[model samples]
Target: MNDAFGKRVRRLRLDRDWSQQELSLRSGISTPHISSIERGKRFPSLEYAKRIADALGVALVALCDDASELRSPKMRGSAEELPLYLQNFVLNEEATPYLEVAHQMSQLPKEDADLLSLVIGLLVKRRYETPVLTP
Candidate 1:
């Protein structure tokens, strides 16, 4: 079991105000198993990871690895310097385009860039999920 992976899971769970039992209930995993995973006594299979990620409303990648590792330099602040919530939020797969757009919009003021990125992210998510009507 990757200790780092387990830590990530525990962190995400806590961020959602979930206890191990709560996470187990939500993910359909047992409390003991969840405890083992969080303690790094056991590793989660891909399927189990997917279940947990789904229950946590996060992308599987967010639990398996540090999203900051994949982020652009501008996004990679010292982990200690960033809030856990913001770190988790930025790491979500759905936030990728928003982060990228924010990077491109860096020339703009920080507040403007952030707002624009959020708008773009919402539009992108909606466009992808919205069904096209036939003519």
Candidate 2:
């Protein structure tokens, strides 16, 4: 991986106040591997990258700026709407936790995407007809 991505990994790890060993345990990756990734000594495969992202409580896209378009086509509208709603919605104590899950909606499968979209639509208290899906 490039040094910039390594820096991003290190920053995210540090943001959670987690040591490399801690990250390794959560990620199911070895501490040495985690160290290598953080130091830009290795380029991890997508699987490893995904482990790192999930452990960081961030979506895979968060780790890969260039991969923003990697999302599944199912529920594209909801995936696109998440950022807008998050940007404009007023803050409340209860809404904080859901924000993280919403960020992860990009990776959800079609069935889960439908469920989450319903929940998010309700959470936003918006009035909109649901989109029909074609297999």
Candidate 3:
């Protein structure tokens, strides 16, 4: 499970310029243990994995991904390009509603999914373009 997890952790940690000691303090895990994990000498148990993920401010699943978050538009360009609501999407259980919607969309036929996407995009674009009237 941790084939690339260690590298992902190393990348994320380095991205923040955080030392292993800082991560240790934030994750409540010892520095030596973190070193082992980063070196791929050990696999973190699920409990420790979640702890590390939390300490890193990323979803646990993010650690499993091979840098998808690194290329995510939210990290690349302006935030306004993504919808305000999706800009900070947490990749955890709290995002179940969004996850479920995405799952349902995946089940739909390609044309149906595309149409729905277009409609949703247009609606969001129109709403953003509309001016709010003051009372």
Clash count per candidate: 0, 1, 0
- Which pairs of residues clash in candidate 3, taking residues 3 or more apart in a chain or in different chains? none
Which candidate would rank higher by TM-score, 1 or 3? 3
TM-score for candidate 2, please give it. 0.52
Worst 10 residues of 1 by lDDT: 68-77
Report the lDDT tens digits of candidate 1 across residue range 1-135: 468778878877776667898889879999999898889899888899888866665556667766533211132223456889978977789988866554447545569868887998899999999999989
Model 1: CA > 4 A from native: 67-135
What is the per-residue lDDT of model 3 for residues 1-135, given as tens digits with 9 covering 90 to 100? 766889888877887778898789889999999988999999999999989986776667778777546421113223356776676574346887886686566545569989999999999999999998989
Please report how far candidate 1 places residue 86 from its true position, in Å.
Answer: 27
What C-alpha lDDT values do all the predictions have? 0.72, 0.70, 0.76
Ranking by TM-score: 2, 3, 1
**Candidate 1: lDDT over CA atoms?**
0.72
TM-score of 1: 0.50
Compared with the true structure, what per-residue lDDT tens digits does model 2 show for residues 13-66?
A: 776667898889888999998898888898779999999887776666667775
Off by over 4 Å in 2: 66-103, 106-135
